[model samples]
Target: MSDFLQQVVIGVQLGSIYALIALGYTMVYGVLRLINFAHGDVFMVGAFVGFYAARALKLEEQPTLAGALITLLPVLLLAMVACAVLGLVIERLAYRPLRRAPRLTALITAIGVSLFLENAGQLLFGADPKFFPSVTPQGAGATLNLGGATISKDQLVLVVAAALLMAVLWYIVQRTRIGRAMRAVSHDADAAALMGINTDTVIAFTFGLGAALAGAGGMLFAALTYAKILPLMGIAIGLKAFVAAVVGGIGSIPGAMLGGLLMGLSESFVRGSGFSRWTEAVAFVLLIGVLLLRPAGLLGRFAPEKV
Candidate 1:
């Protein structure tokens, strides 16, 4: 029972990470119906940005609580801003011209962008993995007991942060003018444009907003146990997040979050069962199962077009 509880806690932590990235995937797809495969690369860039931000701020390798927090907030904001710019650039140069082109063309361009970012990242950041700076102060290995289970301070912080970010995103989508514009564009781009909403600008903003979230995900992911950050780190993580979005219903924000948590639980359960080798494959298997059971995902609703 204790083991089960522990796994559940870990699952939530992983879910938080996946949910953050999946939100980006769902947002971009909702607006453009484009996968933006390069999104994962933007996440990689975010991690790198966080690293440089830390170094630039001269953060100590081992920091006090106050110092760690002072460094954390600025680095996170910096990473988000950097990735937002990168996202805008990708939209303007690579995707904007092809917006009216065939979906196939746009799809291929997205893949091309993904490849370019990966290779370019390797060239710019080098191929070797770098240790992410710890955001927790030294001697901060605190744990909280839940039933018979223990949850680390890091896990608690991540879960809270993810929840806060998700809440803010929800508010933006539900209450803000830009979010209303986004929805209007998503429902009918032509109609929205005719109604005087700047469809093009909205689409670009959607991309930037999603990319910024992905950046936050990158920073949090790296901070987890001080994970290694590599140029290709986003590939697997991005894939999982994509799966989460699909499982939750690609265009539904809430669906993306639910799907992430579900996948995280599944992976954790599989790992606990001693089939750790199947951890990665388990997510895809769950995706296949979900598709077979509900093509539209858990919360997804779809109506077939009349022929």
Candidate 2:
């Protein structure tokens, strides 16, 4: 029972990471109907940016909490900004031209962008993984006992931070004027433009928003795992986040979050059952299962075509 509880805690923490990444996927898809496969790489880039900034600033060597935090905030902000710019560039350079092209063409372009980013990261950051500076101070570990289960401070922090980010995204998407414009464009781009909305700006805003979320997720992931940044790190996580978006209901904001959390927990449960080897195949299996069960996903609603 204790083991089960511990796994659940871990699952929620990991799921938060997935939720963050999946939000980016779902947001881009909702607006453009494009997968934005390069999004995973955006997360990768964020990790690298944070990693390098910390290394350059010697964040790990900071002698005081205030010093470390002073450096961490700026680095995180810079990483997020860089990722947003990268997202905009990709949209303009690779996807914008293919907007009127066939879906297959756009997909091919996305794959190309993904490949380009991976190789480019390797060239720039090198093939070796580089560690990120610890944002959580040393010896900061705390635990809460829950029915014989222990939840660590790190897990708690991760879960809360992710929830806050998701809340902010939800507010922006559901409450803001720009969000309304986004929805208008999503529903009918031409109609939205006819109403005097700048569709290009809306599209760019969507990409920037998604990129920012991915950047935050990348930072969270690195902090939780204490893992170094790597070029190919985005592929697997990206695939999983994509699966989460599909499972919860693609294009639905709440659905994406739910899908991500559920997928993470499901993976944990599956691994706990002694099927650890099946972890890699879980996303594909879930995707196939969900498609078979509900083609539109759990919350996805199809729009009626105009005759």
Candidate 3:
């Protein structure tokens, strides 16, 4: 039972990160109906940004609670802002011109952009992996044992922070004016434009918003879970998040969250079962199973295309 509980905690922690990244995928798809393949690389960029920010701030040198708080907050904000700007730039320069082109054209361009970012990351940050500095204060909150399962303060912080971000996102989507315009554009860009909504602006905002979430996920993953940073790190994680989005219903925010949790739990249980080698493959297996059983995903609605 303790073992089971431990896996659950670990699963939820991992799920939270996946959920953050998956939200980006779902949001962009919701508005543009286009998958931004470079999103994971954007996540990678966020992690790097956080890494540099932490170093510049000399966070590792300060081991006090106040120092940790200062380090964590600033690093997160900096990563998010930088990624958001990158997202806007990508939308303006790479995707906007292809908006009216065939879907295939946009998709290919997305792939091209992904490759460009990956190579650019290598050129700029080098192909070697860098260690991410710790932002959690020493001995802060210690490790708590819950029902024979132990969890660190960092993990707790990661989960709570993710939840807060998700809540903010939900509010923006359900209650804000920009969110309404986003929804309108998603439903029908032409109609939204006719209704006097700025479709282009909404679309760009969607990209920026999604990218910002991905950035947060990147920072959290680096600071809390894995401390290794690399240029190509986003490739695998991005694919998994993309799988989560597909499994949750590509354009549904709630679906993306559910899918991310499910993916994380599934992977955790697989590792716990002593099949760590299969951990990476499990995401795709779950995706295939979901598609076979429910093509629209666990929470997604299927809409028939007009011929």
Quick one: best TM-score, which candidate? 3
- For model 1, residues 74-130, the per-residue Cα lDDT tens digits are 888889999999999999999999988988899899999999999999999999998
Q: How do the residues 4-34 of candidate 2 rate in per-residue lDDT, one tens digit apiece?
A: 9878987898798888888888888888888
**lDDT assessment of candidate 2:** 0.83
Ranking by TM-score: 3, 1, 2
* Sort order, lDDT high to low: 3, 1, 2
Q: Worst lDDT window (10 residues) for model 1?
A: 61-70
Q: How do all models score by TM-score? A: 0.95, 0.93, 0.97
Model 1: residues with Cα > 4 Å off, grouped in runs: 61-67, 303-307
Tens-place lDDT per residue, model 3, 1-307, is 9999999999999999899999999999988889999999999999999888877877673566556666689789999999999999999999999989998899999999999999999999999898777667646465789999988877888999999999999999889999999888878778899999988899999999999999999998988775689999999889988999999999999999999999889999999999999998888888999999999998888868644
Better of 1 and 2 by lDDT: 1
TM-score of 2: 0.93
Q: Please report, in order, the local distance difference test score of every candidate based on alpha carbons.
A: 0.87, 0.83, 0.90
Angstrom error of the Cα, residue 2, model 3: value is 0.9
Q: RMSD of candidate 2 to the true fold?
A: 2.1
